[model samples]
Target: MEKKTNAEVQVNMHEEMRRAFSLLSGKWKLEIMWLLNQRLYRFGELRKEIPGITQHMLTAQLRELEADGLVLRTVFAEVPPRVEYEITQKARGLGPTMEALTAWWSEYGQSVPEKPSMRGRKAKAASSKLG
Candidate 1:
C-alpha cells in the first residue's frame, strides 16, 4: 500500500465522518432513533411518542432509517397486519456516544439560565402596575 500524506488522511477522515452523519441527517431521524433505541414501537405508537411529527413525516423518516442499516422494520402476518420498529445492533453501538452527549448537555445546562416565560413576565408587569 502507498503511504498517504497527512492532509489526505485528514480529508479522508472528514469525509468518512460526513458520510456517517449524512445517514442520520434530518430533523426527526435522531429523535426517532433515540426512542427506538429504548424499545420497540408500532407506527401509531411512534407517532404518539414523537410530538410534532406528522404521519407523512414519520413514514418518510422510518423509511429512510430502514434503508440505512440502523433501524429494523418487522411486519407480522395477522388480522390487522402489525408492524413494529426497533433499532438494529449497529444503532445500539451509538449508546456510548449518546451517553456522552447527555453528559455534555447536563454540564452545559447548569450554567445557562432558562428563558423567563412570557406569561410570567406579563403577570409581573400587571401586578406591579396595580400595586
Candidate 2:
C-alpha cells in the first residue's frame, strides 16, 4: 500500500466531513428531519409546525431533502391531493447524532449566559476535549 502524506489524509477527512454535512446543510433541514422523525406531516402541517418558514422555502427545502434521500415526499390520490413528508431510513440513521446533540446542548448549551460570548464557548470546548 502507498503511504499517504498528512496533507493528503487531512484533505480526505475534510472531504468526507463535507459530504456528510452537505446532506443536512440548510437552515431547516435538520429541524424538518427531527420533526418528521416523529410522524408524517402534511405540507401545511409542516409549515405551521416550523415558525417563520415561508411556503416557498418549505417547498424548496423539502425538495432538496427528498433529492438527498433524507426525506420522503408522498402524494395521495384523492379529490384533493394530499402531500405528506417523513424522514427516510437514511435519515433515521442520524437519530443517534441528533440525540447526542440534544444531550450535549441540554448539558452545556443551556449554561451559556448569553450569545456572542466566546469565553464560555472556549472554556466549554476545552473542558469537553477528550484525547
Per residue, candidate 1 scores C-alpha lDDT tens digits across 91-131 of 99988887787799898978888885432112223434453
Colliding residue pairs in candidate 2: none
The per-residue C-alpha lDDT of model 1 at residue 109 equals 79
Determine which window of 10 residues in candidate 2 has minimal summed lDDT.
117-126
Compared with the true structure, what per-residue lDDT tens digits does model 2 show for residues 1-131? 99998876675877889999888888788888888988899999998888777788889999999998988998989869999888989988998998898899899997878766331113223456578
Give the Cα lDDT of each candidate.
Answer: 0.84, 0.84
User: Can you give the TM-score per candidate against the true fold?
Assistant: 0.75, 0.75
Q: Over 4 Å off in model 1, which ranges?
A: 1-11, 110-131
* Clashing pairs counted in every model: 0, 0
Q: Give the Cα error of residue 7 in candidate 2, in Å.
A: 9.5
lDDT of candidate 1? Answer: 0.84
